[model samples]
Each structure stands twice: as structure tokens, then as C-alpha cells.
Target: MTRKPTSSDHIVDEKFEPWERNGRMPLPVVWVAVALAIWGTGTLLTTSGGAPETAVEAAVQQDRPVDAPDSGAALFAANCATCHQPNGSGVRLAVPPLRGSEFPAQGPELVANVLLRGIDGPIRVDGHDYDGHMPSFSAAFGDAEIAELASYVAATFGDRDDGVDTATVADLRARAVGQGTWSGGEALAAAYPGLPPQPAFSSASVTPVSADVSALIFEGRDDVWACASCHGDLGQGVENTPRLSGLSADYIAKQLRDFQTGTRANEHMSFVAKGLTEADIAGLGAYYAGLSVPSTAAPILGGDLKRGETLALVGDWDLGVPACFSCHGPSGFGVAPNFPALSAQQAPYTASQLAAWAGGHRANSPLSLMDQISKGLSTDDRRAVADYLASLPAVPAGSTGAVAKEGDGHDL
Candidate 1:
């Protein structure tokens, strides 16, 4: 009877682990772990090239006072490393090397001067010549900070200790008066004969480019960004860059202000706009406003301009969308004041902006007209109008009216 009643007698162990059946993990678990480890190793190998250092890390390193502290390593990586390179090997015929070079060893005085004034023209370093321009750090860095940078360059690259003290830098700053960029290395070479003999590099000397303020628009806002990288020079819109030139100054100003204020939600434009000052904004407006509209490349976006023209001239009122020209003006040149010029816009840029408006990503357009118009159009309609706009002559022979003027409500 007892043997026959044992159907429900098999109790499972509460603390049992299938993986610990033996003394170690099961073979399958081990295999899974090995696969994970291999994957992790591969990930690390692939991700060895992000940033040399971040700004937060550089700021943190500045806690020390006396010499170039352990923090200078981060500071140097942030600033000097771009041209002289992280290891100070530098770039050929562009920038001179600091590694094993006599430049950094010529005492902190010379280094401080160069830092304050900026050096240009042919310079020899490690038996090579670099004819590149070095922008002045005087406007950017303070005495203690520049000293720390110089100290780091000498110790880390020149392999020397105790280059420039902060006090010495302050003293030099006091003596430093009017600003003029250094012309060549002749004066430096004559002054510091004890410096190491550097071999001259044989390469074409780089021509100087205008870098005052306008260059920032084309070159970079800082080392990490450039408007020209997206928008072409003269504000000709690139692939997805909106045409910036010939827009009403007020329109451009408002857009930049919106971008800065987070009223606009573009990651790229906002980032660049954040660093621009009010004065900078005004100057840029003037610069671009003065330029005549430049022609862009042919439309790569395939759309029927004829169909697009219909959308531009007369909208489908059946769908409650207004003619594109109704607000843009008869010539699509934009009414001066708030509206932007649409003539000769890039097709891709036009389409993208329209799409952004429709999706509610761009709500900064005047009167919410763009949002309404974009949402009403089908994708094909959007493409058609964008292509049609791109085909218009940027600057018509008889039309010099790219700037918008304040007036409204003459529906054609």
C-alpha cells in the first residue's frame, strides 16, 4: 500500500540551482559567459577613438595652483593637442612638433610671448618647417592658465620640468602691452641661439586666410564646429543646410535667437548658436545681407518642378493650403522683414525644412503658416514645391529684392 501511494511524494529542493549541479557553472552557462566576454573585448577594441578628453575633465584638472599639476595633462589635451598633437609629434608643414624640440625648452618667456601674440610664417621644429598660422590665445586664456599649458608642453613633450611659473606669467602679462602677431622666426632664432637646431621641412608654405570674424562663419565657431561644413560659403545652402544669405536680417536674428533660447529644438543649430554673442549675431546678419544670392548645384532630389510650380503659385485650397507665393511674395523672393527668401533654395533643404515643420520639430516659422502648409501637403507635393523652388534663379537680372519688407494680405 505504501509503495503504491508514492505518486505525489517527489518533493523538489527549494534552494536547488540547475547551474550548480556540479561545483561550477554548467557548460552552457560557461559558453554564454565566454561569448559575452569575447563580445565585450571586441566592443572595447572598436571603441578606442572617442575623445582625447572632455571639457569637464579639463576644468577639474585646474584645481592645483603651483606648477602644471596632474590636471595640465587634460588641459593640454583639450587645447594644444589639436595642432601640436597629443604626443606633440605635430603635423607635417602645417604645425611644428613640440616633442624633442627646443621651442618649449627656450624658457617660459618665449612660450608666453608666442601664446599671447600668436606666431606666424615659417618656423623650424625638430628639423622640419611649419608655415601655419597659430591663433593668439591671449584673448582666450589667462596668465596662470597659459603658464600651466606651457609647463605641460615642456614637461610632457620636451621632457623638461619647471618651465613657467604662474607668477612669472603674471609678470610677463604686466609687461605685455600692445598686440601684434609675430611675423617670422628670425627674431626668435637670433634671440635664442641656445635652442636646439631644427631641420627645415620641404613643403609648400600654407597661404594665410582671413580669420578675423567672418572666417568663423566658414571655418568654425570653435575647433569642433563650422557653419560652412553644413551651409556652404556665401550662405548657399548645402545638402540639408538652409539658405541663410539674403534672408531678412530680422528673420535671421529671430531664428538665431530662437535657437539660442531653445524655442527651436535643433541639436546642431542650437549648439553653434549658443556661443554666438548679440554683436556676433548682428555682424553675421550684416555680412550675409550684403552678399548677392549665389547659385547652388542642380537638384538631386527628383520631383516634377512643373507640378511643384503649381503648388508654389496656387495651393490646393481644397485642402486648405495657401499658395506658397502668397506669403513668400510674387517672385518667391520673400517680403522684407520677417519672411525668408525661398528663390534658389536647395531642394533637399527645402523638403527637410517642410518635413520638420509638418512634424512639429520646427514651429518657429512666422504665424505657424509653415506648419499649416507643410502638414496639408502630401509627401509628393512637398517634393514638387521644393524642386520648383530650387529651380528658380537665385538672383534674377531684374530683381534685386531678396530682403523682405513688412507688408501683408494681398492674396493673388
Candidate 2:
């Protein structure tokens, strides 16, 4: 039935043709092709609205439509209770009280700005200065979330209004972007007129005898509060507070004597200075004047260190904020009598002061610009700006061309 002798019948081809080649397709290769085809089909199906359902969409479709609750108390408890405390009393000399604060009761715009931008530096509230920083909520929240927060604060802590809407939040955000960062209350007083005057501190009336006698005052006491308490341990203040660490002894003694005689009327300092004897004042002044100016600590506020540096020096036009060096000096080693040294101050302390000014807690300066400036900040901006300030190196003594000398009162 089979012809085996025929050469043509024998399956032998000396010249192989590409079309006649026979080989097994690799399992891996076949699998890869099938996978690619399936992927392409899935993509097409998805685009065509015939794709398989995702867990999220299916759940959303099946779930009941629930409205967000209108409970400010609940929202505050959930979000702000941790730092502000449940009763809003706040920490002593640390985080400021939110209850009954003018900031909360002022306007929705301010509240929204505070919530969005946060706060920094020496903020004055009800005549009391709070030197701490508030963190930002912009990154964590959207327009709707910001609206909810503003609405909650307005209804609960602040005077009740129609409530903050999404539009208001958006408007505030736009304005903030135009305004940039805010300066402390003291700076505002200096920049603007028709603002309230700064509160007066009581000055001491003690006369200096000699440096030898001044050193004796601290002999028995291991560590009592020094001239650095209100003036900053390093004599570098964020704002409002004056730097005294690198001043001449004469300047230091003069301030102490002024405080004793009621010439100055700082409530806190007047009380402290009144307790010191004339000899004690001379010794304290000498000690501070003799010490070297310390370096600034690292910034605690959240932001890019490099970016902060740029903003501090050059400022951001998009936000309508000014360069810090314009007023704070290039090295941040503040000038005497009013300007404070910002080089080595704490970041939180700086932030707190800014919030106080914006909220109208502290006011005793001649400038209205600070109020305007503070109104423009968001919480995030405040933190970033403050962090930059904190990152700056300390200005060495005599860096500002002031020589260090005992009884000169120019060491701080």
C-alpha cells in the first residue's frame, strides 16, 4: 500500500525553507503572548466600560449616602483636642488658650487663615505674649475639609455666623498665596502707625557698685533665673523680647535701673527686676555682658531648609510677604532697645508670637502693618518660615560691630 523506494516520497529537504521550518513553541513564549493579549483586552474593556468592577466602586455604589454630621464639638474633639486640650484651656506659658480668645471670635477669614497657614513668633493675645508656633493643615486638608474646620471653629469657639463656605475658603487661600508669610506683632507696630502702643515694663532702680560686687550676687544661688529668662537664655529673642546677652555693662545696668524706677513697665520683668538690689543688678549685667553670644538652635517648624533660607533673604512675591532681613537685619542679630535677635531663638516660640499678633492677643506697637501681615499667613507658611529662621547660624559677638566689654551694657 506504501511506495518506499521513491526519493520524492521520502521526507528529505537539503535546502531548508523558512516557511517549511518546524519547531516546538516554547511554553514561556506562548504564556507571554497570551498574557499580553489578555492585558490588551482588559485595557480595551476598561476603556469601553465593560471592565471588571473594582472593590472601591462596587462598595461605593452599594453604600448608603451619608451626610457629614454638623457637630463642631465632635470635630474639635477629634482634631484639635490633643494640643488645644478638651476644654481649650491650653498649656501654661506654652500653647495658648483658644477658648474666649479674640482670634477665634474675630472673623471667619482670620480663622480660616490661621487654620490654613498656622502661626509663628511672639504673638500677643489679650496683652500676654505667647512665644510658640502652630503647625499647618493645608497639606492634610482639601478645600472641603478646610471649610468644615472653619465652619466648626466659627460655630463653636468663635461668634456664630452663617458659617464658612467653600468659596470663602478658596478666596482666603488665594489671598494667602498672595500675602506670603506674616511677621510678629512687634514688627507690625514698627511698620504701621495708628496701632496700639506696646505695654510698658517696670524698671529696676538699682545702681552698679562694681563687677566684683556683681559676681557676689550669684555666689550662694546654684541656679536661679538670670537676666536671660524673659530676655532669652542666649539673649536672642524671637520678637518683642529684647536681646541682652552681648550688650555693654552700661546698657545692661541702665535697663535694670530703668525697670526698678518704674521708668519701664513690663509687668513680668518689672516684678522680677524690682526684687533685685542695686548691687545685684550690677553683677547680673556684668555676667551677661561677659558671656559670649550662643548660636541659634535648629528649626522645629516643617519646611525645606534651603527653601526657607531663600524666603528669609529674598521673600516670596507670590505670597506678598517681605524679606525677613529687611527688618530683622542680615544676620538676624537685632538692633538694640526694640529689635530682638532672632538668630538663636526657638522655632515654636517664634511661631506662637506670630499667631498672637494675628489674633490680636498682643498689641502695643505703633505699626498696623503687622496686623495686616499676620492676617495673610496660613499655618503651613508660618511653620516653614519659622523653620528657616531657626536654621540660621548664630551671629557671633561683635559681629554687628559692637565690642564686648564689662559695664558696657552691649553684650546681648
Candidate 3:
């Protein structure tokens, strides 16, 4: 008596409504279908276990800081690859190629400007038109991060061996504080068409006390020995001593300051610098910088000329050494107030300095760059490089040295 089998129980009323009377999908079911579609599209950021992740949660999962881009490559991959492409080939007619572009070769400033200020509207690169918008990176990156990004770009695609430094980028940042995105390539080119500004001290501090300075160099003061006692009357230096002529004022001032503060330790130099006032230091710097370096210094050592030449021109990277010219400047003329003229320096003096650096005795160089490099050099290698450096003539023969005057200290 199980409610006797009835045919009516198996059939539903055709006229009666189930849940809704309307012949449409239910709203709840529609919402669920939309959610499933969204999941299928793969827009969800997820963990390895396939759990959904929010922005902060994703950072936590990856163990990366919320704001940090991780690395230069990561920064470029995230921010630049869309239009620039992963390799920096860029989109034809829409974007520009970074590789072989004359812009990167021009200098760091142009490249830095574009990155910080973005480019809007049209710009031509390598004779091709790039008409897309490049978003500003100023807000998203710090100077150091930007420098790294620029360096990565330069190294990877632009064929620039010397990478951009943070100080340069920071300088750029200071200049670009209030500037907006670039209007056009032509305008930008017009504005900064010349050389980027040089950072060293370009002017002398006090009036050129040429005769007084010359007297100071030739005659000993109460506290100091006569410079000429060790150096030549012209400050050209005796055997094994360093010549003070043709060096940058900034370089000379910094050296004297370093000696005075014990940042650069030399018994003689420490005493000499300690006896001089800041004005005296600046006056001496101007006097020396005004004089031209002699074309040649008498050799105080001998080495394999061929090996020394190779080291000066192109360094042996296997030995963890860079060429002398790379940092010293092209043709060893000098790179302003930092690396002085290696050419025409006394071989013995150069060798002694290198030895000092190797033995951890001197440590005043920026970033200790020289100290690290010297430590890696062999004794023979040092001697060879020093000899080659002393062989070069700073200028043509028949040129005379500086002539002390009343006030004006012009190049002689």
C-alpha cells in the first residue's frame, strides 16, 4: 500500500510553473555562469597551488617587496616590453628600436630624459616614425632604479660598454623635477643639443696668485718644505717624484683636501696639506692645472713594451683588469678632476702608487675602484703598465713649461 503505482505521479503539470513562470535563465544561475567564464579567461593571479591572490597577497607569496620591481630585467619586462618588445626591437612604425639607435650613443642624458619624461605624439628614430605614447617612469622609479634600467638597456641592446651611474641619474632627476613629458623629438633635440654638463670644478676659487704660488712652490714656509726640493723648480718633479702640472684643479683640490683629512695617507703630503689654507690649496690647484704636461718623462723603469701597450689600450679581462685608457680617458689625456694624465707620469712614481694600492696602503679613490683593480694586478703587469704610461708625450716637443706672473694663470 505504497500509494499504488500511479501514472499521474511520474508526469508534471505542463501548465504549472516550476520556480519561475518566465521562459528565461535564473539570475543566480546566470551569475554563476559569468563567474565560470571569467575563471576560464585566466585573468586571475594565482599561487602555485591555484589559490587566488590579491596584490599584497601576491607580493607576500613571492616574498618580494610591495613596491620593488626586483631587478632591471624585471622592471623592463613589466613596464617596457609591451611596445619596446623583450629584446628592444620595438614595433615598426609604432615604436623605435633601442639597438643601434644613435640616441643611446649620443649620451645618457637623452635616454634618461625619455625614460623620466615620457614621449608623446610623434618621434622619428633611425629614420623611422614612432607615433605612440611612452608613459613617464619618473613616478614609478627612483634614480638608482632608473640608472639600473638604463644600464641594462644600454648593455643588452645599445652596445654601450660603460653603464650609467646613480649620481648621473640623480642629477638628471634634479633637473627633471618640474618638467612634463616631452612635446616632440625635435624640440627636445633643440633644447639639449650640446654636450651634457661636466660636474668638476670649472673655475678657480681665489684670484690667481701666480707669483705668490710660484714662491710657495720654490721656497719652504715655516711649516712646510720647499716643493722644489723634491720637485723641479717648474714643479715638473725629480726622478721618481710625481709632476704636478697639467692636472685638473678639482683633482688637485680634492687630493690636497684628502691629504689634510688623512683620507689619503702620505707622510710628506699630509704635512704639506696640513700647512696650507683652503685658499692656498685652491691657488696651487689653479696654478698647476693651468700648466701643460710635458710630452715625455724620463723612464725610471723598463718592461716589455708590447705587453704594456696591450694593457694600456685593451686590458686582459681574464686577469680582472681594465685598460688604463678606459678610465684614464682616450689617448691618456685625462678625464678631468678624477683620473689624471697617466701619459708623461714618472714610471717609478706610477709603479709605486700601483704598489701602494695593491698593498692596501692607499684608499681615497671613489668606490675604492683603483684599490680593487690594483689588488688583482701582478707585480710585472704593474711595472709594464707604468713604463708604457711614462713613454707617451703629452704634447709636441719644443713647448716650454709654465711662467709665473702677477695674477693671470693662463695655459702656458
Local distance difference test, candidate 3: 0.65
Could you give the C-alpha RMSD of every candidate to the true structure, in order shown? 21.0, 20.8, 24.6
Better of 1 and 2 by TM-score: 1
| lDDT tens digits, residue span 156-252, model 2 | 6766564676777778777767453344444334433323443332122233335544433433223334444455544555444544554445556
TM-score of each: 0.46, 0.37, 0.46
> What overall lDDT goes with each candidate model?
0.66, 0.55, 0.65
Displacement of residue 204 (Cα, Å) in model 3 is 21
Best lDDT among the predictions, by candidate number: 1
Model 1, range 1-412, lDDT digits (tens) per residue? 4566575556657897776656866799999999999998766555644333544466566545746346567767655653466778764443467877787877666777778776654567776654534656776677777787777777776667767877787776766667466655654676578765433333332122335445677677564366667777667777777777656555677778988999888888888889888877776665565454335734568887667877777788997887776677654666655666676778888888888888888886546777877889888888888887776545321122333345642210
lDDT of 1 at 159: 65
